[model samples]
Target: MSSAPIAAAPAHILELARRVLEIEAEAVRALADRLGDDFIAAVGLVLASRGRVIVSGVGKSGHIGRKFAATLASTGTPAYFVHAAEAAHGDLGMITADDVLIALSYSGSGEELLKIVPLIKRQGARLIAITGNPDSPLAREADVHLDGAIREEACPLNLAPTASTTAALALSDALAVALLDARGFGADDFARSHPGGALGRRLLTHVSDVMRSGPAVPRVAETALLADALMEMTRAGMGMTAIIGDGDGDRIIGIYTDGDLRRSLASGCNFSTARVADVMSRGPKTIHPEALAVEAAEMMERLRISQLLVADREGRLVGALNHHDLMLAKVI
Candidate 1:
């Protein structure tokens, strides 16, 4: 370690940080307002292409390009990042005639990127350039140029690529989201790509995946004694039991819960003699077994209930779930 005392940040450090955020935010807002037919032309090019999108850049712009590629891939667009320097060294073979190249260079001129642009064009690949200067060589060469210019950098010295990179990243995200919408990419599509993520589980996990099924489901006939229903609830460990029609494996008509038991006790109802139907909440909220588990969780939250009965299209009880079940499944 260097034997130098660490300088403390000035008292105006908070103000400087706020100013940086303000500048970046304003830069992004300006870019958003500046967008026009050029952005559309760029989107059109990508949508028309038969191959993947290749994002290329160097330095801080490279970082933005990588993130843009990832966002595009995750949102249904097939895209990936290739370092501009690497592309010049045999990596250029990755680009094909059908591919669309998205080049990021705030200054509109990076030696490494410029070196490969001609080869990319010669290979018949279309280029979409994002730059600060509309008159730059890269912008002039691009089939479509997106002006990502900003008033100034957020850096105190105004030399760093703070606001510029932020604007590029935001612009890239805007393009990715537009592509996502244009392709009619839905939550299920997103979940398919991100199956291990929490949003994936929320979108893909069905009631059947987390619900108690078959003999595990607590069920009692409408005519069954309250004691029998309590036994079923205890056996299933779900804190509630489905009140079904008289026959075995009948359609659910109501549900009896621990809350009902408390109400029954308060009302001086005879648990020994009372029938399940008498204490059950009739026409209880039920979800289809194919319904997403997150839907059930939301329903429970909105209704201030803990448990739900999962049923088939014919309204026959097929399964059951509780807040605990959703939690265990990581669907909540």
Candidate 2:
């Protein structure tokens, strides 16, 4: 690697950054005051449409449009992004007569968007324009025009599209969220759309999917010796073993864990011949295998437990799980 001297500027970098944030924040805050009849119309139009919601824009506005489309798509609104330039290059065919198009153009005069707005309208697709100019051609052509007009830009030279883009993005979010609420979208719907993420796993994974069953569950009869419980726990590597009564239809008598072992040793109990029932703790916590894994995790966390037993309605042990099992399932 070659050593090079770093170049330094003489301006107050932090002050300029702060001023930019203040301007953008004010621009977005002003949007709430502008939520009039037009905003409502836009939301109703998208909600009532039989087809998808297509978000289109160019440059910085295109970036925001992509995020807006993704949010809408994940929140139960069928939506996707189409670049304005690409639309003019034949992507416009994707828009159908029953679809709703949300066009983002801060200046309301982007040539690429204006070139295709007429085609979209002629095809019977409704247009929702988000722009800083109300009287511009694109805004005039829209079925619903959302005025994102800002007094000043965040740029120091007042040339870059900073505050204007931020306002347009915030407006897009407002419209998408309004539509989401109108559709009665919930967390389950969101999780369904994001099944590969942690939120999805937490909500969709059931205890049965992660619990140890059959041969994997460390269990022993109440008549078994303390050494037997220890052997079962060691074989299963779960740090605990379930103790069940022999004549009581194998009904749970108690649970023997390392904690119980420690206490028994501290009490000077002889493990060589002592029964597991003598040292096991009774009335151990249990869970249903059909319950959500996250619920099990919550229960364990609330009770400060490292392991839990899974039983059916008849009180028969079906499975077992511990913190390590939960971690393996990515449910912790």
Give all TM-scores, in the order shown: 0.89, 0.93
> For each candidate, C-alpha RMSD in Å?
2.5, 2.8
The lDDT of each candidate is 0.93, 0.91
The residue-by-residue lDDT of candidate 1 on 1-332, one tens digit each, is 98998776886778888999999999999997999999999989999999999999999999999999999999998999999999988899999999999999998888999999999999999999999999998999999999999999999999999999999999999999999999999988999999999989999898888998889999988999999999999999999999999874578899999999999999999889989898899999999988888899999999999999998877899889998889989987
Q: Looking at model 1, report the run of 10 residues with the lowest lDDT sum.
A: 6-15
lDDT of 2: 0.91
Local error of candidate 1 at 72, Å? 1.1
Question: Which residue pairs show backbone clashes in model 2?
Answer: none
Tens-digit per-residue lDDT, 93-132, candidate 2: 8999999999998888999999998899899999999888
TM-score: model 1 vs. ground truth: 0.89
Q: Give the Cα error of residue 302 in candidate 1, in Å.
A: 4.2
